[model samples]
Target chain A: MYGIRHLHLRNPGSWSPFEELERLQASLERGGVALGGASAGPAIDVWNEGDGLRLRALVPGVKPEDLEITVEGDALTIRGTTAVAGPQSGDRWLLRERASAKFARTLQLPFAVEADAVKARVANGVLEMELPRSAAEKPRRIPIQTT
Target chain B: MNCEMKNGCATVAEPTVAKATPACDVWEGEDGVHVVAEMPGVDAAAVEITIERDVLSIRGKACLPRASSRAEGEMDAVATGYVRAFHLTDTADAGAIQASCKDGLVRLLVPRKQPAQRKIAVSTG
Candidate 1:
């Protein structure tokens, strides 16, 4: 391991031991609180696959009816919400860690994607969007005759 | 001492806010069990739904983006609230539960477990 001074320079965001412990405790406490107060969970991972770009989002509990996908040029916007179901009930719960509220995530594509040919599917709590490259944007090859 | 004794019960028994019971519609058919939740503003990514032993639990947060003044002039779409729940039920299949969100409605399909197969022997006639 590098010296403490060198390590601190390399990782500017590194906190002291006390600070780290405090942060850990804060996170645990936050998790124990009611759902809405905690931070957003995971972020979507996107990649470019030679011929096209594939975007995958981990949207676990949302229903098919509560999601909407919109693409404007290279920017994609996913908007939707899950409704709280059930009547008011009187009960006492020791702990509640799930968040119940609305949220939206938007992303700008790095490369130009064929907006018309894009396809999306949600299965097993994952949303996958496949965006193919436009004909004009795809790589072209030239064939030469043997001299 | 007298005031403490008189209000001890009152202090311990603070009136609790009546928690609202989430309204959902559940349907069971040969295909699977379908559950529809009416959450308005929650995002699909923020929602966590699980089915264990036939009990379905859905939890997620909703954060509506602040509308820009320019966009307000162009469009009139309003976002509402969030969606969270721990549904305790035996009607749904715990092993094969599928969920999706669209617009403001959440639809869940929990397929029942398949039955075991029995071996059948055929004798030459």
Candidate 2:
């Protein structure tokens, strides 16, 4: 129940929009939930709940002091860069496969999030962020008076 | 192959995972270089980090238990293994390499051999 809720699908010119949307919908339905296509960025997971929306991005090798999180209107953007200093003079390698560069991703929320209450934390290599729901968006209970 | 080094260093083989690629924090002090890599689902014994001269190599397999348990189903969010490698410089000391694994992270320390100091004798002709 506590997993990705939306996944954004792009046309990518290989498939029609209708076909893409249908596949996306089917995948979500088959999984017993949905994450709209607009949420799947590199190393990222997006979800929603009664509280509002949450986004988690896995960015290893990056320090918390190096990240930047920003929200404007319905869009949320995360950006950061990682750098590795050169090694010693005699180290040789057989195979090297790891990504290192600047990264940026933007996402749209299903409902308006209280931007003021959004929070982010980086542990290990995962970046977790939570956006609270607006006061007006929260559920309210009405009083019933017996006549 | 064109080895055009970028970022003020000689280029090695380019990495394949272009976007959102996993990286490691490398610290080079007077004695050694410390490398901390994020390798989720990988065990301490399973990982192997090697350095020869100036090239540093990292290779491992991350396996998820019960990954093949389900025979028939939608098979959503299946776990898979990962293998990554890197080429480093010769300054990394191969003899004092130390590594540790914690919470799916692998930390490696490669010490550098200090150059021996020698004095030259001057003969007056």
The number of the candidate with the highest lDDT is 2
TM-score of chain A of 1: 0.61
Which candidate has the highest TM-score of all?
A: 2
- DockQ class, candidate 2: incorrect
Estimate the TM-score of every prediction.
Answer: 0.39, 0.46
Pick the DockQ winner. 2
Q: For residues A44-147, could you state the per-residue lDDT of candidate 1 as single tens digits?
A: 54655547676655454566687788887767777655444422233212222224556565566655677888998766445667878777766789898998
For all candidates, the clash counts are 40, 36
Candidate 2 ranges beyond 4 A from true positions: A1-41, A88-94, A139-147, B1-36, B40-97, B100-105, B109-125
Estimate the Cα RMSD of every predicted model relative to the unseen true structure.
20.7, 13.5
On residues B22-104, what C-alpha lDDT tens digit does candidate 1 reach at each position? 33555444555455654444557756675444234564444433322332111112223332333333433466678887644
